[model samples]
Target: MTDTTAAPRLSVRTLVLMAVPALLIGIGSAVVLRALDLVSEQLMHFLWDWLPGQFGADESTPWWIFLILTLTGAAVGAIVWLVPGHGGPDSATTELGGPPPKLGAVPTILLVAILGLAGGVSLGPENPTIAVNSALAVAVFGRLSTKIPPALLVMLAVSGTIGALFGTPVAAALIFTGTVGALALPGSLWDKLFLPLAAAGAGAVTMLLLGGESISFTLEPMGAIQPIYLLQGFLIAAVSAILGIVAAFLFPYLHKAFHALRNPIIFTTIGGMILGVLGIIGGPITLFKGLEQTAELLEHPEDYSASQLALFTGVKIVALLIAASAGFRGGRIFPAVFVGTAFGLLAFALFPGIPISLAVACGVMGITLAATKDGWIGIFVGIALCGDITVLPLLCLIILPVWLIVTKAPELTVHPPEKAPAAAPAKA
Candidate 1:
């Protein structure tokens, strides 16, 4: 009888060779992300600190925030209109795993991303940074070696960028599990994960070495998982998921409304002005992409009243929707995290007995799931932010009901307008 078993397709030598480029790309991508962070920090410092100081105005001056955001909108609008490739594709039209834009589009994408990040536009660097890294890797590797698969290059770039963003390979692995697990080809699931895991490990290590901080917080850990807490967590997540669904339904309509202007300059500039107004009302706490702000919120949860937290949540959701739909180049994850945190704090204020960490984690999971439509990532970020393992079992269980709520919810993506057919010839 013929042997039914088959040998492994990739030998150890071949695997090691593939991993070499993955490792290099991971480390290199992490360094680039760090550099972007530095540049963004400098710009933000200049805008919020030095510029205000020069005007003899404190950072709390509401007019300055308004003026800067309005101008930022105008600047971003100009870049989109004048720059080549129209500042890359509209972020609203792309998913996290979508194909990277052409290499030539990278410059404009980076420019707009930096502007949005530093100029307090209420967006995250996740989308643009990933796209940039992926495009760069695909171009460089495609030219250097035809042996490397394009899919592999994209996978490495995405995994590496995610690793750097989350400050760990674990997040990358969890995030990509659903994507990789569905592949029909390959051996075991780990076999498929081998190269991406290698890249993620390198990226995470490199980012840590460069002094990048992970999204973690030290909270009062749960002593033990309780049935009551699980019930509460499920309820909280369900509520948050409903809120997220509401936002998802609103997303496409808002996107279309903004695009109705049909000119990037008019629409983006106007969107920026509205964002500036929201920033003024919401204060400094509601501005920016929100990772640092989320930490601040957790550290001083008592400082904010229930009303303030509610306002923060509402304003942040609006900002996220507007920033994404109106030509901003960034991701929704960080901003969604902020919204989730605000809602969690609001819940805590209302119900003092419920554990704050659990409440916050549930909120994060629901909102992130709604925004990214990725359950594993949502749960991971939720647990990671609280720095608690005890909450994992609860989260894993709670995510089921939350998933049901969001599964059929409209996705937070925009469809581009179709070009009208040319008019019939006048002679006809």
Candidate 2:
């Protein structure tokens, strides 16, 4: 007798139906994110352009920049300290795709995000955008259909938001592959990604329509991978990874030190002052979220000396640490990419023989891997930025050794505070 057993399968119709909600969520997320970007742009214009012009103070002046950042810090601190939901958990404690905060906390999260983005905090919109979208997604999808799991909703929101953030579905898909691949569920990985990919595609398209910037850059295409070039790439990647590891190790201690102040206003304000000083040292070019700065650095690599590039790299790293640790609500990845780009440029400047694109790609790979603890996305970003496929094989090879260096390194996140030494016995 022959036994009749059937393999588990997903219904095409079910997946197709799910895509509808996913697309809608993607578009919605894009619109919300675009609106926030516009608001941030207007506020920044007022702070950096209008206000400075009115006072007859050079907007690029270090002193004026310092004052604005310090004031921005105080305002953000006030919101986090006095606002409801404490600005929705310290961003230092959250991961890129962590659990969402409650719906009631969404408004506070948005406020904090706006303050951070417009205030020149060295952070990105990734965390708050994802958090807000996740919260809204859960609420709306939950009411619409009891059949859809909360986990799926979160994935859709994350996929959609990240798609919009990077202005591409590829980044979202690469970032989520490892996440969903680990699940012990039926169906192929693509099967699980079906709805989320639909969402991501929609989000990416929506962002393009809104005129968001793409992360890709035009670089001289690497002709071929030479052995010497391979070794050079490896060394660059190794050094960059070490720098990232050092930052990761210091992150927790910095968080603890800031929190020891016991008041958000005090710590964040102090953080702002330090960041302002760093900004002055690094100059106005190093000030914002680093996306535009990265482009500037790449476009005019000849304008800055090797030492200047190195300073930009160091200052941005320190600024990122300070901003993230001192209760600022933002993501670290964007700033990390900037740091990586600077490091790459510095490497190219130091050693003129190696192709600039290859050096930059390695730099990006190493630092991004250490900072994000996600290998695939790091590699993707590196290649995407360079827009050179010939370097892909080299990057693939370089990542092997780089991953070994970073795999055991501490992630850049703060754990819950230790139980205050068990509260020493009451002094009767």
Candidate 3:
């Protein structure tokens, strides 16, 4: 069976011609991602650091966390209400590589993304980075050549952004495998992938050159994988995925509830208050996108009790949902990663028998798969977190049951119901 959607096949020559453009797009993507990060970082320092010190308040205090988050929500809500583009569409209704926003909306999208990130919103930069890069790349490069279709340009830019965001082209390739597989163009998959990979590689290299951080963390070398580790991995991952499934089920309802307030400011402000409370409960560790926190967990596992790890896991899941449900503009991956890490650590702490690497890897694999419905990234992040190839074979098996679990469950996104066409007048 094959897809019937007809797409023009590109010759190797055309693909070769586009490779340079793809490479350029990749560089641009990395630059955009790094620029957003830099601006967000500076703003984060001001909001969380400089502002707190002036009042003789520590950022870790509940009052400060509550104040910062509430202010952020108000700020974002004001922009969404007043900004010309309204920060593009509702981010809760979007997905990674889903659709690009209008060119005019790119600036607003990037703006809100930075706001959410620096405001300690529990989300990542993936979706906005891709959204902005794809929009700009297509609008800019579409005029430069007719041979390259806009769709491919979107692909090239998305791949580049993914590469830069993850600090590796390999991550981009793994992520796009399903996308290419679903395309109807006739060619070897590699042929179809040529330009995108070029873009991804270029973007990855640019990010590396620009000192972008990576997602990888080193786990103490656990011994070779035992047969029992597979079962343990599956169990841990399954539990995590089940929790993710709960979030998936609640996603739409939560989104609907938040938007019920109508005005973005009111709903987002309330959401921020909820997140601030969650932050106080989970402490500073639960704030931000989860990369640095995840690394912190691995580096200092002894610092947290099992109950504390569990609290972190649960609080993060709620925070992610609220941040996502409310109109905060960002991706879910990083927050999910943090949740998965806490779950893994909690599992290891409780069992004491499961290998730390296996537990963490499976936890990441399960939760990510359920959270995003993307197994490739689940596997990529699971292995990347532990830096253990030993767990790869087991993650492959663990994903099977996890997929079944999420197969029928709703995806963690919302879709606005389509309006019925207006009835035409029967009388002339």
Candidate 4:
């Protein structure tokens, strides 16, 4: 007797149905993002507290920071250069609707992120984390032979990513859902809305399992609020908004700088040199990664001398620009936040009477400006960076004028000006 066997098939209905469980899975994955956040935080703590002590490196010694800086620059450089598809998703583009890079690039991105962050590169783990999330999703589905829709998979992946990076599953879900909602899809609007919500719910669940916690910032204002203080706040916010636009305008140009360099080792090595020079001029605070540094700055505002803080702020921005120009793989978010916080700190130094809460607001505006090209999106970033969701309405009010002023600043566009059609040919 002969036996016949048939390969399993997936119908459109089956594929659509898969989205339900996928949403459930995505909620679970959000919890995973939280766990990853804990892991990364612990890793950062280990590096700062135990790793350096174990290796006999001390903060007082400039040499340790130098070694960290150079090695970090070199290691991340090598990883990006040697890795296929070069250093993960470009978060600059990805957050604004760029196509996801190949799933094959995941391992390389993970390795680069680990080494770079561990080595003290002034970058965030969000981009690499997102890459890994997508890759894992694809891998998991492939292994299970599941017939989940690709769109659903993407939703779950990004939801987990936002959950992990933000440590706020609700915000992550809302943002992811809102962003996806903005896109054009083949399915009904209900389906589009449903898929992202499902994924976000699952991602939040996953984040909880991964040990992620929501964080809040306590504001200790310098003194009683006054209209004058609000004016100062407006000024600071305006400045940061302009700066943010400038950074956005610079990104495309910076992209060109790296492309023009054309040699990975040379580009990155030279970037390291520039960073070293900037760090030496700026001081230890500006050397190596940014987010933790921003938190530290907030926690101990008195530790850094005014001049030192100012220098660090400038150097951080310069270093970030050079790093991107040199082809380093990292997200611009943390660096932007660091720079913004420094500016806020600087404002406090200048106007000693200003409330610290307002100062933080200024910093939030600055980060908002730089982190996103859209004013609406900047509202969310400002709220997120402030470490307080409650401040969003006030922030919205503050950001509105700042956004208007800065939006007209003529440099907020992410892409460089198109070369005027090559002079259209004196076509005669």
Compose the digit string of candidate 1's lDDT tens values, residues 1-428: 97679645556777788889899889977987888888989999999999899988755788898888888888888999998866787888887767888999899888888899899999998888888888999999889999887777888898998999999998889877778755433566777788888989999999999999789886777777778998888888888778888888888888888888978889999999999899989999899999999999999899999999999999999999999888888988999999999998898889887888898999899888988788989999999877888888899999998898889888878766566567433421
Candidate 2 error regions (>4 Å)? 1-7, 182-185, 417-428
All-Cα superposition RMSD per candidate: 3.1, 3.2, 3.9, 8.8
Worst 10 residues of 3 by lDDT: 419-428
Worst 10 residues of 1 by lDDT: 419-428
- What does candidate 3's lDDT look like per residue over 1-428, in tens digits? 78787555778776777788999999999999999999999999998889899998887989999988988898888888888888887778887777678899988999999998999999999888988998999889988887677878889898999889888898888878778866555677787777779999999999999999988887865687688887888899999999999998899999989898989889888888888998999999899988888999999997899999999999999999999999998889999999999999999999989988888998888889998888898999999999988778888888988899888887878886765557543521
Candidate lDDT values, in order:
0.86, 0.86, 0.88, 0.62
Question: What are the per-residue Cα lDDT tens digits for candidate 4 across 46-135?
Answer: 755676788787643556556655666676677777767567754434552243457778766666666656655566666666666666
Error of 4 at 263 (Å): 2.1
In model 2, the clashing pairs are none
Error of 3 at 357 (Å): 0.7
Q: What's model 3's TM-score?
A: 0.95
Model 1 residue 306 CA deviation in Å: 1.1
